[model samples]
Target: MEVIVDPINSAVETLMSGTNTLFILLGAIMVLFMHAGFAFLEVGTVRHKNQVNALVKIITDFGISTIAYFFIGYWVAYGATFFSGAAELTQNNGYDLVKFFFLLTFAAAIPAIVSGGIAERAKFNPFLIASFFIVALVYPFFEGMIWNGNFGYQAWLEATFGAAFHDFAGSIVVHAVGGWVAFAAVYLLGSRQGRFRNNKLVAFAPSNIPFLALGAWILTVGWFGFNVMSAQTIDAISGLVAVNSLMAMVGGTLVALMVGKNDPGFIHNGPLAGLVAVCAGSDIMHPIGALLTGGIAGALFVFVFTWAQNNLKSFDDVLGVWPLHGLCGLWGGLAAGIFGTTTFGGLGGVSFLAQLVGSLTGVAIATLGGFIVYGAVKQISGLRLEPEDEFQGADLAIHKIAASSMDD
Candidate 1:
């Protein structure tokens, strides 16, 4: 019996043939799973009464981001760039698909940021509305200018500086965006009741360690896709990216263990810190470099978390999004400039000056944009739940349901 293979169509083939698309699809799935991680992490961090609310918010934001990105965000970010038939956005090679996937991941992040701000008491409707704006309009615009081939600011940077700003995955775009927005939301929402009775900090331990651990693991796995898929090329670069990501995570874990003096919380979050730190340079860094970067990030997480809790009085980053995602993302981006290989050629290589500019630019954009949107929303609609809701819990007040059946 003779088996016949259909003629390979190049147009359709390019989309799926290379490592590009495969990496992208894998990244998308990995990032998607991070939502579960977020849910678990946030639920574990907050009071039992707010568990349902936290999970619901994460799930709803993800759903909204998927739909919004597919329809408007994707087109605006990638599809809209094509001029005539020559510039049509190709999906098979995974650029457009990657953009779509990244948008969803981006969406997951924004709500995660807000989770800390409105932890114990947030009205579901307001939260949902805020999510819509972030995913639909706000995120796409910035991402379009950065990663979208047709319209990204990277094109401008490449033309002007002779090299484009590097963000291997999204140390700046995804994580920082969420952090700044979360900062605004929390500021507007005000501190949790009795959080500071006489200008002193209070302790709010996580109720479920198992959930937090699961979430951290999920994020670790997802990060592999996040870092590797950013490299559109399928050569040694991809492998390097994966290796760097792993090394950094391992390094971060070790550092956290040493710094925390055997504390599980610090260790639990070390992998994530490592991933975030290496994200900016995953495609360029060697394995050893990745380990060093990750280790620093892990150590930083311990300090930042503690600092934020103690020193940063107004900012209630419930899951430590600002430190874990925002600060670490910035570190990764800057690190890329310092550590990026000149040997790689093209955008993967960078000078220290260029890296500094790019890192600052990312911070400026995220901070300014976040402050504006969050402030406006707060002024117009009042961004927090009623005091009554705070004492009772948002799950019951907003959703009229408990996170688990036990509450019922």
Candidate 2:
């Protein structure tokens, strides 16, 4: 009887571990699918001649990002290395390995975000080199500091502010960092050749509205996995997170429709803006709080994007990534502290002061790292296509094929 009981207990433990591994694997796949969303979003936004380049850049960046993260970035973030025998690597149902896959998707998002901002004119291989360094070094550094408490950052925040900084998903860690880093790249690359003429802005229409809408739809569906799976285990999954994400998405959609005056681009991106903001607080905030946070983000995107496109002459961000991801992400980070308090109908145990400091710290690190990586790459290899190449389009110039050919 004793022998039978022991065997049963061992089997139970093994079953639980396997279940967790499967859960995380599915989540990783969903987030991996979001890269397609990123690709299509950029492809639809850029001009027709550059569509192939957009598709190529996103998939290539993911490949490079995986190599960088698997060999270096994961170690930098968690101090865990996969340099082990297969038997050892397969222990615990390979949950650790699957976890690495999940986080790598997040890290890869940095290049995908930047691709949109610097689309049209950026040199292909040079930007890929910058992406390698960013994923391997810059992103994982902040990820470790916040999520793992690598130094004493979380401890210090809790002691001084009455609570640790809380980012349930990665509003500050992933989105804001990706956004600000994109701002740096966009600034350094400067406006496209015809983006400004005689001190006035020029508008470039999207190549395909249906494709843009499709991209938005895919991201919206995949985001549930992004926000919910950050739990990293089945036992911790929350209905609250799902509900809050829904509310925020609706809020963003309604506001963007009104504020953007029914513009198709804004309409599609509104839900994405809302999702970005809700990622931080989705687990803790009440649905209403999430709604307000999303609504504000939607309005912010429309107004800021319009103003920047018309007024900002120094840089051209084709996708308006800074406003949609960077600024909205910063707001989401702060909103977690505001809405994730008992006073605001949340579970509490978050500090506004800690959130502010943490949010600002992420922005600073990303900005400095972006400039260093991109600036150095620019100095060494140059950042953009030649004038002749620009006229010919990246597909023909770099890839030696257009997205479509009349002869074919």
Candidate 3:
């Protein structure tokens, strides 16, 4: 018997697939644009002398990351590849291709986060190599386990805790991993010269408030796509995700303003901290729960950033990413359990134990991966610049140019 394909039904399916493909493609573009925010954020925070390097690193890492992800990372994570002929691979209106483009943006973010932590000191080539290794090897391994169930990690968690580990977006997957790796890089790279002089911490003012704020705003706008588009289909889109993100942003801003005493940097970054925390739970939590989660994250960033800079002093993380992305990503993971449960007036079906274990696993993997990768890179090619080079600043020493001619 020959099976007949219905033309009407086939046409409807094609149209729907095309629409979904377009929707996700737009989302990929928005998230890709977030790299500009990351670049500007680092540019504004680092001194004028290092600003060009900051701009260069974000795009360069993104370039390296695309290659790594295309060749290895996507296969490692999803067990899929584009090795097929173009005609064969173009099935489904090339939705899978656009999907890969979207996820690569998230992968590239790992290096963007680290660039801020090690700004003004790290060797550019070594750092790019490190980013390549991370996107190609480290990130996709864990990402495979979490997002693709490559290791049966999700199955094991579901058996033990009555639920699979839930990260609707990537609180632990992207932000936390980036943050912890940043910690290791910052640790190994050490503080900039004169950052801790005579056992007293010295302050480095932001190069430009306007640029920093621009970055924060860009990221804030892009994040709606980052969160909403995680649904990955027009059929699955929800107003709830958008509203939760908005509420969390508002909650974080107000709290950071109060806690930071009107500091412009903190004020701008506060919404980011909130957005970071809400990523894991935005799909499940009520707007009220999201508001609470954002508030706590804002407070946490302010408190921890102050402590890390003024007191800890082991490493100088210029953007405080360890707190902003690392700690808040951890909080986001766990908050998905707390705020995503019926106990917190959320949509429920999450397990606290699962969230705890999954979040911890992400941290452990990030920390250990950071040590191994950065350690090897340091030994092989050297990670930091020479003292003299450091004194001259990254833009001039590495890029052979200044952010502005006025500085020369």
Candidate 4:
């Protein structure tokens, strides 16, 4: 067969062909591996008896998210919009399907964050049901309103503030949403047994710091795709995004070492803090700015984690999502406003006030939304496991299998 192609048409066709598609596919694969990292990290942080339960929750979330996101989540989130200049794109049904698949992977990541919070004690059936609600209904609603252009508060902000809100990689949309959900789940679940006694918090140390470290490393690698792939437009911006991500990770690790004084937990979490912090501005900030953002994020994680452990009461956030994702995501959003350069499309040349407002808005919406949804769920069916189940270990109580027993 002889192929005939116009020069301009051929160029555009090539841009959308083999190379770009492969890059997108590779990015998806990297993000997918992060689920494994989450499983290891959650299992390592919880009691040995609860390891299987935590693992099951992680696996179940990944599976459920894939299906939920494919069905209605993708369409609702990215379907149509007259705002953010996405009206034209959404008008055509054909292109909507393409955009749906491209964005669904990111949507799936939100529920994964919620999984860690409900670990160790949540019933698998309820957790699975929640996963569907988060990905299919909850997550898509937010994604549609914020990033999708037509439905979110961003359009109002753009109209009222004279500039659009920014979230280069989903600092607010993905991380904050997940963190809020985690907070709600933990709040409803209550403190683990003996976590608070005589009005003092008891620490439950990580069982395998090595596993946590390994998981952190894997997540760090996967984050490159998470941030860079958001550009959609392939160019020098992608390379810059990759570089900024690496530098931020380095900065975060160095900051952790300086503050932690040889604590493995600090080292493991530092890189994650950096990655999350940089996500909001990875494509817009200078390399030096990326480093500073990461360093601050690392420091924040160290401080916040310690504070939550010593001062916080009644809540045990098994995997530290609030500090890692919630706090750092906030930092990223604000940093994009402060340190972003005109060399890239950032706040139309940077506006600290604007960035602060955007970050704060994201935080408020995510937190309130989470509390409402989780509160309703609690009222209806209750969110936590039975106290006896918690004491006996969720694996045996809920799944009727123990980690050791499985091996035997």
lDDT of each: 0.74, 0.93, 0.93, 0.75
**Ten-residue segment with the worst summed lDDT in candidate 4?**
90-99
Q: Against the true structure, whose TM-score is highest?
A: 2
| Per-residue accuracy of model 2 over 249-345 as CA lDDT, tens digit each | 9989999999999999999999999999999999999999999999999998999999999988877889999999899999999999999999999
**Which TM-score value belongs to model 1?**
0.87
- Using TM-score, rank the candidates from best to worst: 2, 3, 4, 1
Residue-wise lDDT of candidate 3 within 147-187, one digit each (tens)?
99988999999999999899988999999999998998999
Each model's Cα RMSD? 4.3, 0.9, 1.8, 4.5
Candidate 3 residue pairs in clash (backbone atoms < 3 Å): none
* Model 1, residue 94: C-alpha shift (Å): 9.6
lDDT of 1 by residue, 1-408 (tens): 123333445534564555666666676777788888888878878888888888888888777767766677666666653333524555445365565565568566776666655678566666776776676767666666667644556766777777788776887777766666676666666667767667899887787988888888888887776777666445434677888899999999999999978877789889888888888788888788788889988998899888877877776767777788778877887777766765533234576666667777766766676667666777777677889887898888888987678645
Clashes of 3: 0
